[model samples]
Each structure stands twice: as structure tokens, then as C-alpha cells.
Target chain A: MRVSKFDRPYESGRPERHQLRVENISLSFGGVRALTDVSLTCEPGEILAIIGPNGAGKTSMLNCICGLYHPQKGRIMYGNHNLARTSSHHLPKMGIARTFQNIELFRHMTVLNNLMLGRHVHMKKNILTALLYWGWAEREEIENRRFVEHVIDLLEIQHIRKQMVGSLAYGLQKRVELGRALAMNPGLILLDEPMAGMNVEEKEDMARFILDINEEWGITTILIEHDMGVVMDISDRVAVLEFGRLIGIGTPDEVRENPDVIRAYLGQDHGGRS
Target chain B: MMATTQCGVFHESYRSDMQLRPTTWQRLRVVVVFAFIIILPFVASAQNLRIANTVVIAAIGAIGLNILVGYTGQISLGQGAFLAVGAYSTGLLMHYYELPWPIALVLGALITAMFGAVFGIPSLRLKGLYLAVATLAAQQIVGWFVRNWDPIDGTKADGAARELSMPRALFFGDKLNDSEFAFYVVGMIALVIVAVVATNLFRTHIGRAFVAIRDQDIAAEVMGVNVFQYKLVAFATSSFFVGLAGGLTAVHSTNISFERFTIDVSIEYLAMIIIGGLGSISGSIYGAAFVKLLPEILRDVGLWIADQGWLASGQLDQYLPFAEDAAFGLAIILTLIFEPEGIVKLWSDLKAYFRLWPFSY
Candidate 1:
């Protein structure tokens, strides 16, 4: 199948020195503060992990970055754009994509169709061409399918490509969610608990994919996980948050030894075990 | 022992995988079915041909409803209203403005689509039963307006509604006879074109977006699908086909009463999609045929019973009409209870069962 011209990656030429700088981003729901005064920076092609106990505002911060939840104060600067103003629907077109903490896949759709939707922003066929679907529409469809097949290959999900997402096992469903995000060919990908309820083997495979996505694909990544072993093994940098407050941000080793991070985890009886 | 058992057809590419009929056997089956349909008019009587025309028209409307409710997960009870709009608009344009029927048909579809989009706006804030009730209001509003509006003297003195009669269908200045006009122009040819267009639609990004929204709307949003815009497009496109079906119906029957586009017609269209299979183009056609033929079958059975002299003819005839309605309702209930995936799934299961014949596994 021929890949459509639109399915090609966005050529910004050489990858620019992209950086996502979140400065003092504060978020709240009425009286309940979810994230307060959280600041972090992710450099180009680096895998940054955000780690915290439950309700430590890790997902909230990712939501703020993805434009799903606008902060009450501060700014999220991705290169030149202010992400706080960007609508979640427009984020994908602007080269930002994310997965959900709970797998948010189109459950009734086949895995192929779900991943093909990741290329929605790149598809340019209008209704007229779609109805006439033999010429331009078919070409574009084949092209998009080629890109989706690449994602399926990368995620090693070729066996269940035609299976419905709802019928798949939980581990495979998480991988499909990752494939769906990668199908967007995003410059900056946010992964919210991508390896949440997986076995040790599944967690290792997910970590390897994340590392490959960041290094080989030259895509920046923000991963949120409760598994400290996976986080420390793959992440280039780590940021710690405690009850809506940023407690530490540094290289994985530095953040691991930080006293405030230890107090926060130990105080809540979260042993930060593997 | 046959160690080298044949698997099904291999789809080497997404292109092949997406093909409507990928296997040789599937292609052969389709060809045989189409050949049967093409030769049906030659063998069947005029009355049976008329029933076939009704089936095709109903299929178009059913496909439209399936797109909204089945693929897009937006329940709409306003198909009857949209059909009325299409029929009335086409009728008025052809009669008063002396427009060509083809142009009038397109304009009628466009008008009904606009109406459908307006009704779909409420869907942004409502869903499920709430949205269903909101669309039901469209039927009432359109029905009331058509009955009372006197600009075209819509209401007759005897309390019967005015009929919208279509002009003789002109194709390159030649008048087509009733069967040619109805079956060729408005039935088979129209169905083929609509079916092809619909199949092509499901293969594209827009169609995938509709399915995504149906499955998980919040997920669809994060993936860059404009949920509100796509919802409106779904409504508009569904109404477009239903409106075209409405125009074709007027042309086929030569005259249409406002009473024809009632709530009962809306329910029948919904039942067609549900009983046939939701979110499937071929399923829509099967559903239409089943629903449309049920009444005819009941009538034939009634006549046979009366001829046997087992019962009084007048008494049997009186109850036979009610039996048709009861049978229709029972079919819907039974289908939902036994096979919620509908007849298409059931048929596929049977095919699979036979394919693995002589091997219980």
C-alpha cells in the first residue's frame, strides 16, 4: 500500500532544540488544589519521569501540560507556544500527544482503526473526495494505513491488529494505546501511567519501547509511573511532587537521594519499592 | 491426515484487508446475489416489483439512521421529519419553479441536511434518552408545520392533507414508464450508488472518527477529532441520504401524503437498522427488505387462510392488519433478545459453522 504524502512526518528540517518549560503552574478544583506551584523543564529527546504517590498531582500536571486542564496560574511554554491556551483537540496538530492513566481507547473499534485515528490530523481528504473514495481518498487511506502499520510493527502488535480493543488483554490494550499515540508521530509525547497494571515482563517491554521512542525516534517523552524501578531505569531526569507541591527535580540519581522526596514517600507509607 | 489445511484468504496489505470482498468465494457470492437482483424484475410481477422498490427506498433511510445511531452513537428519531422535508422540498421545486427533478433532488437533500444539523446542536449537551426525546420533537414540529401551514394550501377542506405529486421523471427528454422510472431510476441504480458511497465513507478518516466518538468520545477528543464538528457532520450526512430516499419515494409513488412521514415510519426505519445489523451497509439493505416484506407476507398468509374457508373472510381481514403490526414488533423484540448483533452476525455465524463442517473444532 502506498503511503499518502500527508502521512509523512512533519519536516521541521533538522530537529530543533525543543524544550517544554512548565513554570509555577497552579491548578485547583474549587477549594481542592490539585497542583500548586509546580515547575519542571524537559529538554529535547530526553525521557522525563514524573513520580509521586497517589493524589500527588502527577496526572493533574500531565493534564495541565496537555491542555486538558488549564492552570489557574503560570504558563506552559513548549518552544514558543503557550500550551495553557491550547485546546486539547488542537494539541495533536501542534505536535503534542498523550496517553491516559486508564487506557482510553476506542474499545469497539479494531486496533488498526484505533491507531489509524492517530493520523486524523494528517488526513486531508474532504467529504467530496471521501464519497468518491477511489482516487485521492484511497491514496490517502493507503498512505495513512502505512503509517499505522509502522506503529503496529514498532509496538509488536501485528497478531491482534484486527482484534477489537475491548476484547484484548489489559497489557495488550496498554500497548495499543501507546501505538495509537505514536501513530500521531508527535514531537513531544506525554504518557500517564502507561505501565500501571502490567506484570514485570510487560513493564520491561513498555520501558524498552519508551526508551526506543525517545532515543531512536528522537521524540521527547514525559512518563508518569508508580513503578520506581522502571522510572529510575529509563528516565534521564526525574521530578518529584508531594501533595500538589514540587519537592525535587534533577537527574534520576540526584532525585532518588533527595531528603524531601524520601520524607514525602516515607511519611505516606509509600515505600517506593520496585 | 491433512497436515496442510488451508486457512482463509491472506490480506498482505491494509488495502487488501479493507476490501469489501477480499476472498474469491465472497466475490463469487456477491456476483451471484447481484445477478439475481438484476434479473428479479423479469421474473416477478408488477406488484412484487413495487414491493422491491419500497425495500430499496427503505434501505436508504435505514442506512442513514445506522450512520447516526449505530456508527456515531447518536440516537435520532427525526428521520421521518427529514424525509418529509426532502419530499416536500423536491415536490414544490419541481412543480412551482419548473426545476429538473435531478436538481430538485439535490436541493431537497441539502435542505433536509440543514434541518438535521440544527436538530443535532442539542446533542452537544444531551445524550442517550435525552437526545432521543429532543429529536422526537423534530417529528412533531415538522408534522404540525406541514399540516397547518397554508402558503401552499397544505391542509385540504375535507381534513385530508394535500398530496405532493412529482412531475414525470425526464431523462434526456424521454419519459420513462412506471417500472423503469421506479425500479431503475429510483430503486436499483440509486441503491448501488448510495451503497458504494457509504462503503467508501466507512474506509476514511471521517468514518473512523465517528466510530471513535461512539466508543469513547473523550479519547477521540485527545486524538485531535473535533467532536462537535464531527457530530454535526454525522447528522448532516445521515440526513442527506434519508432526504435523497424521501425524494426517490415521492418519484416512485408519484404522490406522497404528509401522513406517510409519521412517527411509525421513524420507528420502522430504526427497527430496520437494529434487526438487520447496526453500522453495516449490507445490513441496512437486509433490514429494509425484512421490514418491508413482513407486511406483505402477513397479507399473503391472511389471504391463504381466508381461501381455505377455515374462517370468515371479512373477520380474518380485519384482524390480519393488526397481526402485521404485532408481528413487526415481535420480530424486533425477538431479534434483540436472541441476537443483539442482528441478522448479519447470525448469518456470518452460520457461514463459519458450515465452513468448519465435519470438524467439531
Candidate 2:
């Protein structure tokens, strides 16, 4: 039988296509291999979902893409630039932004400040200017604040703009985290379990926001999610991982019908759905 | 959550413009504080002035410690050692090279910052208790070398006898060997350092990164902050301020000794930050004043009680010696248990309560 559109076979991008590419990536923590020879590529403006069992190294792959982890073996290429060798600090500048599996909002700061921190990569003011709050610093601050406000509106978190992130509800906090990542205005965005513990309503809201972010923002999105329903609904393509190896790669319908992918989910009642 | 409700209307008003202090009352408070500081020298007694100067200098050190320990969450027992570097460098430069006091002070701070950067190398690899131990070891090694090395002190040895001398002050052609002069000098320097640190800390990326790292290192790293570089910067910045305080203390006093900058001094700084409220610039000043003056007050009270004929002089001496130490220990324990947020927090809370009174439910 022909593979479903959801499980469409991997097609190499055109020669001039600017996209993020991972080649033969492998990462081992101590003796445990978190990822082994895992390769995936995400094109601009495409929502690629990496769905896997609990220990299938979904988050690990995201980490490698953002330069959080230097794979023992692999090359992460972003828009023709080799990122594996670049400093992690330079990732945001290189148009890559990420949110954590566990919401990583700056708890003590206001939601607005947390988002503004994302703009730190692009801020051009020096220490002297920042200290004096003069000249270019004031202009820079105003510009960044406007950009952060735009992100807050985009994430639909204007009500919680001045609220401390720690004080916000879980769903709002997640949204604020998304706002923070969006403030970076990256060409590629990574979302790790964005809807991890949310109820159905919250999950729906998050899924809509994620879809809007990818579509309206015109940004490439790589999502690691356990909610197969949300993944199937929003993802243009899906990559299924089982024990550090990609079991299947295609569109959602194709992935849903893959025998290996079904067996990986059925082998153990992972029960990750909320 | 319960305590949050008790916050007063003034706090609520201030909280509305938390980042922007646009209120007239808030601006008035700043003016009042500056006025009090300006008038303090004239109104305080000689002994009080001396004590206030010590508090100011100690506050500078505590501010540095707050940046490292309180904000960055790096426990450093070696801050006193950095202070020693500054103090000794300033003392040596002023005494032997006849450098001006201002030049000596600047040079002292620069050298100390450099030394702090050097010592910060080990922190790139270690954290928590292990990092604390490393800094403690640094303290011991730096302290020992400074104490033993005569050349560093600008002193020549004469058959095992160590003759230490006080640095001379040359400001406005009038020598500043008196307590009042030292008090003014230290106070001005302390004020300048506090203002610079308070304003610069939160406004800069490095400062924000330090706080982020303190909360969660892995999360911060993932956000593209150079965790190692920021951490090292915190150590270096904290140490520079600490060293400047040490140099000021050395010049402020008539005599110099190794015992003054011992591990005990470092612990004292830690205590100040703890009691003052961790992660607060103003708290450092409050903590420093309380720690420095509390003993002096106790000593005076003990002396007064001894003169009352209710207690024998010999008995008083035996009991009084331990009394101050015991009182200080109890204060720390009680503060930790009851007011973990420290005196500055309590003060702010009270002020907030007053501001929001009647409507504060």
C-alpha cells in the first residue's frame, strides 16, 4: 500500500533552499545513548513534529538543534552555516530560539521583562549606554519594548504583561514562555512539550497559538510533543522515534498508519497524554 | 500568599509603577535619604562617625558579596581575601611609592578586579559546596601570602620582626590621619560604589544573566546566555567591589593586621547579606550598619550595667565577653528562622503596609 500523505517519505530540499539540517547526530550520556545517528531536516515555514516514546530522545534532538548539546557525532547546519561548532551564545543571533520542556520563564521578572530578555541577542547598546540610560540605549530600550509588546499580543498574553511569571497560571506561563521565544524573532523556533500538562481547552489554545505562530509569523517550527492528537492536527510532517532511532518519517496520516510507529507506541502503554 | 494580602496601599501604589518610580512620594524618599546622609557627619558624635564609616565600608563589601552569593548563588568565602589584595595594594602603593590616595584607591580596585578574575577561573568548572570550598581555599592562600610576604606590604624585614605602618593621606594639603577625615573619605567612596552597583546591576544583561543562572543554570544556558562568562563576570565584579572596600578599610584605620581580613571577616560579610536581605542593594547597607553597631551598643550597655554595682567588675568581664558573641549568634538564628527575607524585607513590608493602610486587607 502507498504511504499516507502524513507519512510521506523524506524528500531532500532544493539546492538553494535555506533550512536547518541535522546529519547523523549521536549523543550519549555516560553509557546510555540518548540519540544514535539521528538525522532530520526542517525547511523554512514548515511545522515538523518529532513524536516519540518517553526515552526516545525527542528533547535531546531539539537540544542538539539549539546548540544546547554538542552531539558526539553529527553536524547541525542552519541556513548553510555549521552550528555544531558555533558557540551556544551565538544561536539566538543566528535566528534560532527555543522554549523548554518544562516552562523556563524568568520567574521573578514581569512577563514583559522575560520576553525582553529574548531580545538581548539583538540589542546593540553597550554597557556604558545601558548604565547611563542615554543616547542609543533609550532608543534601543523603546524599540525592544515595542517588539516585546508585539510578542505579548501575538501570544495573547497582554493581560499578564506586568504580572510576575511565577504568579501566572500554568497555561499563561506557557504562553509567556512562547512569547519569550517569539521575542527573539528567529527564523527557526523549537518548542519542547509546549502543551505538556495542559487540559483539553488549554491544549487547544496552545495548538492554535503554535499554528498561528508558524503560519502568521512565517517561521520554521520544530516541535517535540507527546500529544499525538495535537501533533496530527497541526504538523505538516511527523518524525517518529523509538529508542533513539527514527522509526518513521512522513505526514501525520502516514505516521499514524506506520506499523513500526504503532508498535513503538503499543509496545509499552507510555500513556503520556494528559 | 497570605503575607501578600497584608501589603499596604502604598505598596500597591508603588507596585503599579514598580519599574518606574514616578510618584512624588517615592522621589521625596530619595531626597530625604540623601539629605540624611549629607547631614549625618555633622550630627553624629566622633565615635558614631567612626562606626558609621565602618558600616559604610562594610556595606560596600556586603554589596559585592550580595552580587556573588545572593544574586548569582555563588557562595564565596574568598571575598575577604580579595579585599586584602585591595587593602594591601593600596597601603603598599601609598606608603612606599608615595602615590596619591585617590590614585592608590583606583589602582587598588583595578588590581583587585584582576586578581578576582584570576581566582574566578576555578568557578568555571565547579559550583555549590565544591565552589565554596575552592573559594575558601583561595581565601586561606591569599591571606597567608599577604601576611607573610613583606615586599607586598612595602616593608623590609629586620630579623623576623614585622614593622607595619599606616598609609599617609594627602588631600587638600591637609593630612587626613584623623577619624573624621577617614570617615568622610570612606563614606563618599561607599556612597559612590552603592549608587553605581545599585543602578548598573539590574539594567545590564550580565546582571540579569547572573540572576537567571542563580535560579536555573540549565535553563539559562538553553536561553543562549553564556552562563560561564556571566558567572565569571559576577565573581570578578563582586570581588572588585569587595577589594575596594578592603582598601578603604585599611586606609581608614591607623593600624593594619592580618586578623582583620581573616575568614571571620568573610563570615561577617555573609551574615550582613543574610540579615540585610539577599539580592537587595539597600539591604547591604542596613545589614552592615546593624552588624557593626550592635556590638558597640551591647558593649556600652554592659559597661553601664557593670557600673551599677549590681555586678562585680571581674564577673562582668567574664560574662560580658561571651555575651556579645552569644547575642550575635542568636540574632542570626532568629533572623533566619523568623525573618528569612531579612531586615530590609521587613522594613519594606512595613513601609508598604503603611502606604496601603485602611484598604490593606
Candidate 3:
């Protein structure tokens, strides 16, 4: 099989020329290989979706990219920096932000406060200044609040900004989680199932928001989602994973026509490519 | 134009636009409390004032424990250890070295904060039951070491043991033998600590991170909070205050012993936080006062009952034996069962009901 023309241009930017590069990564937990030789490339201003079945290490791959779990083998390169050696706390400042599979919003904090936490890395004022809330600290606080208000407006969650996150509806809570990640204003945003348990209309809305975030903000997005239709619609390129290995990587149409991807999804031989 | 601007200004001054504090009722309450504290020594008996001083000292300890256990959700049974460190540090400095009172107090807090950080390192790595055991072990080890150390007891004989002694006072080159003066000092320190704690908490990122880690550690980590660093900071801050309270306690009393800073004292502080309400500044003070004064009240009742002619004094000793301990245990169990949120919740609800009396649904 030959690489398609549309896929070739995307491949030129592979691993080396991109903002985040995951090369031949493998991770094992207690004798169980969670990820094996999974390689993916994410560039600036692109939506790269990773589609696979459950336990295919989609989230584990994201964890490795964000420096949560150091892969047993392989390297993660982020803009001339080796992610393997970088601390987890430094990842956010390095322009990498991620959300969880289960919504991990700070339930007790107000929606505004939760978003404010995302800006913790950027807030420069120290403890003494913050205690006084005068001089540079007050200015910093106002600037951060203005940025957070912009995020709240962009997500259309202004009405519930003061309300506790735990009291919001599930769909609204998911939106607030995205707002929190957006507050970081990262170069690459990792979304772990952004529209997991939503209705069709909600999924469509989230897909539009994801596309808007990529096109308008020029932020690269690496999304792990199971809904192929939503992934196919929003993603410029998609990677298919089966048993922690990359089975297909191409444009949506080429991946749709791949024989291995078809087998991985349908669990049987399909005459799409062969 | 003037009329329109006046109307806009009037609208801006609506009831909902009012500030959070210094309400009419709150102002009156503050005035009353200040007056009560000022006049209390004159009206209350000396024994009663002594008990009040104990409550104030316990309040200081409870506030410190609240920072560790209430806001940060770290299980710490070594608060009593920090207290002992502070008391002994102050005692040694004032008695042996003849340091000034203010300098001794500062040194006591600093030494305790350093010790707290050492214990906090393991606490950051281990949590829940393991953390509890670690702090409990600290309490035991520190208590035993201080009790057995010959220099601390000021005994010249190699094996002789005695209770440690604290200097009466550090100011004016004179001792503070009066109970009233001790009461005033403890009360002033307690008031200042509560104010500072109330102001600093929730104002800085450290405070918010402590609360965030308490609610969800994983989420806090994902949000770029250094959980280990914040946990250690919580321990250091909490223990420093505990040490300050210990120093005040040593000054408040004539003598100190290992028994005063035992695991039981730690449990008593825990009970104060639990019965007062977790995560509330006012709750710590309330719990401390209730736990400290309840026994004395019960003892008075027991004495009155013994004199009621229904029971002879000799028989009363047998029947109502250990009345103080029994009351403390009963109060803890009853508070847990009926008002798990603690006395703070009850106070809040009462105030809320009054505020929204006619409109409450």
C-alpha cells in the first residue's frame, strides 16, 4: 500500500517539525502493556483525533504526552524540549493542557474560580503581594480576571460563572471543564472524550466549539474520542489505534477506506481496501 | 441630567448591593463581645477565669489544628507534639538562657515550624491511615524524649526525674504570678491569631491550593498545583501556630509535664474541630471553648447534686465517678450523631433563619 497524496503533506511535518511529537512510545503497568509502539504527531493549528476502542491506550498515550506517566521506552519532544525529562508541573507552562476522561472540575469552587486556577501558572505575584492585594498583585488579579471573563463569555457560561460547578448540569459542567483548559491558552490542548455522554445536539455543539477553538484561536488539539462521526467531521487528520498500536494514519477519507481500520472497527474482513 | 444621575445612584444603593460585613446586627454583636471580654475578669470568679484562660489556650491550639485538618484535610495527631516543642522551647529559653518573652515566643514558633516540616515530608508522601499513624508516632516519640531527658527536667542527679518548670513572666524583669494577667495574655494572643488566620486564609494561592487539595488531590495536581509543596506548607503553618499556643500554655500554667502533651490532648483538639465544624475558623474557637469548659460545668453540677441531701457525699463519689470524662465522651458521640456538621452549622442556620424569617420557604 502507498501513502496517499493528501497524507503525504501531513507526514512531511511528522515528529520533527511539529509542536508535540510522540515517537514509538511504549508503556507497561505491572506486566500489562498499556501502550506499544504508538507514534503520533501534532502540529500547531490542527485537530488530530485519536480513535480506538476502550483499553486501546488512547488516554494512556495522552498521559505520556503530558508527562503524567513516563513511558518505559520512547521519547516525547515538545518544541525542541524533551518531555521525558521535564517535570509534570512544567508541562502547563510549556503550553500543554489536558482534560480528563471523567470530568475533573473542582466541584466546590465557583465556575469562575475553577477557571482562575488554570491561570495559576501564569500569575506572577508572590504570596506576600497576594496577601496584601495591593500594588502589582491587584493589577495582576484584575488582568487575570479579565482574561477569565473572556473565556467565560467565549464558552457562553457567563450566567453560571458565580454558581458552584457541582450544581451545574452535566453538559454545562463539561463546557466549564473546557473553559478551564482554555484558560491556560495552550499551544496544544488535549481533550479526552469532550462529548462522551452528550445527546446528538450537544455533540454537534461541542464539535463546533472544538473546530472554533482550532480555527479561531489557532490552538492545536489532540482529541481522543469514540464517536467516529464527530471525529470525522471536526478532525483534519485522524489516527486509528488497535491494541495500543497505530493501525491507520491519514485524512478522514483515506482512513475510512483503509482495510485495517475497517477490520478494527467491524471486527471482520471488509472488502473496502483489499 | 442631574435628576437622572441621582436616580441611577439611588438604584445602585439597593439592599443587595450592601457590603458583606458590619451589618447592623453584626456591629451590635461585636460590641457586646468586646464589652464582655473587658468586664469578664471583674465579674467572674478567679476559678472561672482560670477555666476561661484554659479555653483561650485550647482555642489557639484548635485554630492551628483547623488549618491542618479542617482546611487542608490532613490528618495530624502530632499537634500536641508541636505544642510541647513550643512550650519547652520557650521554657528553656526564658529559664536557662533568660531570653526575652517576645524573643522566646518567636524562637518557639520557628523551631516548631522546622520540626513540622520534617514530619510534613512523610505526610505528603503518605495519606489517610498512614499519615495518622506517622503523626501519632511523632507525638509519642517527642513526648517520651522530653519526659526522659535529664537536662530538660533540670535534675542534677543522673537518673533523677522531675516535671519541667517555666518562668512566670519575661517582661519588667518580674514574674506574672497573677492568674488574671495570664488570662489577659492568653486571650490577647488567641484573639490576634484568630484575626490573622481569618484574614490570610482564602486570600493567597497557598490557602486556596490547600482547600483544593483537600477537596480533590488529583484535580488540584492537574490544575498545576504542587500538591506536595502545598501539603507541607499547610503542616508548617498549622504547627507553627500550635507551637505558639504551647508557649502561651506554659506561661499560663505554673508547671508542665509530659502528660499535658499526650495523644489524649491531640484527640481533644480533634474533638474540638469535629464538634465545632470542619473548615470553619469560628468552629475551632467554639469547639475549643465547649470542650474546655464543659467539664468544669459538669463538675459544678455534680457537686451540687451531691449536696442535694438525696445522696450522701461519700456515695456521690462512687455513683457519679469520672463525671468529667463521661460528659466529654457523651458530648462527642451525641454531636457526631445529631449534628455532624458541628456547632457552626447550627449557628449559621439560626442566623439564616432570622435573616430570611418571613420570606423563608
Candidate with maximal DockQ: 1
List model 3 lDDT by residue over B169-190, tens digit each: 7445445435565556546655
Worst 10 residues of 1 chain A by lDDT: A6-15
Candidate 1 error regions (>4 Å)? A1-17, A268-274, B1-8, B11-14, B158-160, B170-181
Residue B299 displacement in candidate 1 (angstroms): 1.3
Question: Candidate 3: deviation at residue B40, Å?
Answer: 3.6
- 1 or 3: which has the higher DockQ? 1
In CAPRI terms, model 1 is classed as medium
- The alpha-carbon lDDT assigned to residue A196 of candidate 1 equals 93
Q: What is model 3's DockQ versus the real complex? A: 0.19
Question: On residues A120-230, what C-alpha lDDT tens digit does candidate 1 reach at each position?
Answer: 998989988998888899889887777788677778998888778898999999999999999988889999999999999999899989987787778899999999998
Error of 3 at B71 (Å): 1.6
Q: Write the per-residue lDDT of candidate 2 for residues A1-274, one digit (tens) a residue.
A: 2113232111211123258888898899999999999888888889999999888999888888877788899898887678777766778767788999888777876777687778777676655565555456656666566566667656677666767778888888888888888887777889999999999999998998888777766778899898888999999999998889988999999988998998888764557763
Backbone clash count for every predicted candidate, in the order shown:
2, 12, 0
Query: Highest lDDT, which number?
Result: 1
> Tens digits of per-residue lDDT for model 1 on B177-295?
36553455446877888888988898899999999989888889889999989999999999999998888776665666788999988999999999999888888988999999999
lDDT of 3: 0.77
Name the candidate, 1 or 3, with the larger lDDT value. Answer: 1
